[model samples]
Target: MNYNESLEKLLSLTDSERVSGRGQHTRRYDLTRMRVLLDELGNPHLNTPTVHITGTKGKGSTAALIASVLSSQGYKPGLFTSPHLHTFRERINFDGEPITADEFAALIEDIWPVLTSINHDGSHGFITTFELLTAMAFLHFERKKAGFQIVEVGLGGSLDSTNVVQPQVCVFTSISLDHTAILGDTEEKIARDKSGIIKDGCVVVTSPQQPQVMNVIAQACQDHGTAFVQSSEECTCTLSSADLYGQNFDIVAPWGEFSFRTPLLGAHQLENATTALVTLQVLNELGFTVTSDSFARGFRSVQWPGRLEVLSEDPLLIIDGAHNPHSIGKLKEALHDYFQFRRVVYVLGFSSDKNISAMIQELPYDNAEVVVTRSRHPRSASVETLASEFSRLGVSVKQLDTVNEAVQYAMDLAQPDDLIAVTGSLFVVAEAREFLLNIPPELYPSLDAGMPIR
Candidate 1:
């Protein structure tokens, strides 16, 4: 079968992402099934060293940053992230290129028989969809002889399918309340779950966090006999300048001082950049050769599309995939710091499971014109629901049927100097970005993946 057919086979399984990632029972995340699948695949997870990153936010960017540096330094690092902006291939990349559609089709075909057996036989309690994909990633990395793998946890770290690997370095970006029903409602509990990736002998690096969150991370590292380094404590970043185009900063770490520049906007990215840099230093201590020049080149070259990315300048349109309240707050901060406008129009949509009310409160609304819409994503929150939430905040809200409609309305309403911020879920931002840039949605040659396997 071709790529689309292969994806259909995969999506016709138990997928939590498609169902809003709620109703996640304990049994749904059992790692035994994943372990069994990996063993059947000849334990490909063991073939490569790992850098595992987990957090409510910034994990993807951190993974991208590390992968960029490693690639620039002549290392073949397999990078795995989740909840793609446009396609399933975005979740799996090596040497800065996403796996081609044919490669994906072949991987699925080769593993289908074994994957089916694991799911049907029930000897291992049935592997879930994500577990199967994780297995595929390991197998692909092994096939490629990847020097190291930089993996971002799909959900919480403890029982995430990707947690099967014992990482040499574990990274945590800013932790907050996300995936609350499955992970936890409180920040401390969530921190505990995310900290579960800290295995023995691994070095831990974390962005500056709340005191309580830091406590949980420290205790977890202590329990695992892992070394922990807090990024803000170990390194200081001085932002020389920032604009919608990019930002330039200087970092002072234990090893030395270095200047860095990246097209990734926002203040939170500074934390992510420092966390990545500190982790790379830890990798160097563990005997990976990453020169200062590679660091400079990597920062300049790393591309994390759809995170505070500018798609147009005439109307000052920017899109970010800030789905949760904390991330929305950070998005607000970035807007305030990086751009100026007298009036703003927000093209907003969200997934059904997200805390819409809280996020509405977090999002800035002064002189804000609201256009509510639903993305085509299966879990997209209803336009009516979003409109009501914004109305409750004393904001005048207009309803549009789709992201494309909402973006057009927002553009018509905004002046050249006004900002049109398209955000909420990445799914919505993906649709908006595609429409704005005239790029087709980036599935696997016209395909997609849904469901978790169990």
Candidate 2:
């Protein structure tokens, strides 16, 4: 099968991301299905050592950090994250690059027989598109004989398909209220769901969390009899300086102290970087080699798209995928702290399943104008819905039919010195990023163009 055809067939399966509200997703998140599917494929999830990362906001960034450092040290590391910005291939990265299109299609073809057989038998329930992709990642990593697998959880930790692996280090990065309807309504409940990634033998590392969230994670570690590494308490990270281009920071760990730099913006990245440092330290102690030089280089070069990424300076354009309310607040804080501008124009959109009301409450109503819009995804929140919220807050808001139009409108409304921030969701950011960066669409043949790639 061709790449587009393979993608279409895979996406045609049951997808939880497109399913909104409560109860629906909770019913489908059974890890036994994943285990059974993996068993049929010889349990490739167990072949390589791993670092399994979970939490609401920074899981992807933390995973990218560890994978980059490991790759810098001459290890063939595979990184698996969710919600691709452009192509589905971005979900599975080798070293610093995504798996090639040819590889993806071929892998699907190779596994088609076993997959069809299980589907035909209907023993483990209908496998989801995410389950299939997770299996693909594990199998691909095994075939490549990867030195390590750095896995980011797709959803809540315990029942997430990626939780099958007993990792060398389990990481939780900045647990906050997100996916509230499906995971839980409270931070404590969300933290408990995330802490399920803490397997008995693996060391657990976490960023600084709210007191209640911390208590939940700590209790989970105790239940597993696992060693818990609190990055905030165990490591002191001091930000020396930050600018639009990059930031420099220093981390003092119990093992040693080292300086680091990353082009990624936002003060929150300091926490994610620190969390990665602690996880790498644990990985190193667990018989993996990580030199300070490699760590320094990796931190300097890692790229995680759609998070405080400055695309241009002429209009002072910035794009961030602050999908949830807590993240939107962080994006607002970062803009105020890191950049200087006369006026700001926001091109915003978000997924429908999120806490949209709380997210709207986080908008920067002062010195900002919002151009509300929707992405191609079926779950994209309506511009009317977003505009109503903005209007109620007594903010200047306008509606556009598409992300491209919204970005253009924001740019037109802003002077060259003013900033235009495209955010709210990665699906929105992906569309805007494609237009601004002159990236051609990674199109699938005859597929629902916006089939909720998360």
Candidate 3:
């Protein structure tokens, strides 16, 4: 099939990311089916050493950092992430470049026959859109003969489609009450589900977590006889300076001490950088030839868009995908620490499944003007719903129909030195980025254009 046809076929499958509560109460994932599909295709995931990362936050950033470091060490690493900000190809990358459209279409064509054959009898159950994408990534990595692969878990770790690989290293970033309805409500329960990626005799690295969450991970490592390394306990970071452009910090790890200046802003990013450093140290022990210079170069060049991204300078437009309360709290901290503005204007949109009340409470509405809006996604929460939540919290709110309208309204209300932030969900930030950057529609098609905005 061609590019558009392949995209259409993939979009016809069950995509949980767009449809809320699609399989919340059901066991939608089957690891056995995943393994069977891979086995039929020669199990390409086994062709390269892999690093598996999971958590509620920082998984994407950490995975990118690891891939960048490996690339600096002269390795072509295949990176697979989830829930792309724009095109679907952003979910798969090789050596920091997205897989080209021709390569993606070719891979889909090669796998379509196997996919149809497997679902012909319906005994194995239909593979999900995410599972198919995961298989495609593995196949592409094997075909290119990549030096390494970095995979990010799309959801809860244990039953995720990407969990079939026997990774050499497993990393867990901060865990919180995200995807609670599916994974579990409490942090401990979510940590249990996330710790499922720990394999016997493999090295596992993690960020600092709550006491209960840490207990769950430590016990899982013990049960599996895995080596557990806590980044917080083994490394320390001190921020020297920070601005809207970037931040400078010094990290003291077990290997040695190193200073870094990363374009990724915020204090939480320092923690992510430190976690990546510790993971690289483990990889070095596992026979990788990564050096301190490689780590320095990688941190200096890593790029993770839609997370505290600065788009313009006149009115200072910043966009972040801080959908959860914990991430929203970090965004608030960064705003206070990084920018010098007379006023702050917020353009916010969120999904229906998020903790809207808690997220609204965490927002800086006391000192900022809030504009509630809906993105083009089908699962976006209505502007009325967000306005009601803000009003209930005694915060004044303005309503807008679309993300573009909200951004324009914020810009009209802001002074030259004021700061305008478009946030709450990645879908919202994506729309705002397209509007502000003047990106072509053909280059990044609207995945939910015809759907209702509210």
The predictions' CA RMSDs to the true structure, in order, are 2.8, 2.1, 2.3
Candidate 1 C-alpha lDDT tens digits along 1-454: 7888878766655667665443222246688888887888899998898999999999999999999999999898999888787778778898899988888888889888988887678766755657767877888888999989999999899989998888899999999998889889899999999998999989999998899999999999999888989899999998899877899999998899999899999889988999999999999999988999999888889989999999988888999999999999999998888899988899999988889999989977778888999887768889988878877878889999889889998988899779999999898888987798786774422223432111
Mind sharing the TM-score for model 1?
0.95
Clashing residue pairs for model 3: none
What overall lDDT goes with each candidate model?
0.86, 0.86, 0.87
Each model's total of backbone clashes: 7, 0, 0
- Candidate 2's residue-wise lDDT over 160-262, tens digit each? 8898998888999998888777789899998888888889899999899999999999999999999998988888988899888899998998889899999
Instruction: State the TM-score for model 3.
Output: 0.96
| lDDT for predicted candidate 3 compared with the true structure | 0.87
Q: Is candidate 2 or candidate 3 better by lDDT?
A: 3
Which 10 successive residues of model 2 have the least lDDT summed?
19-28
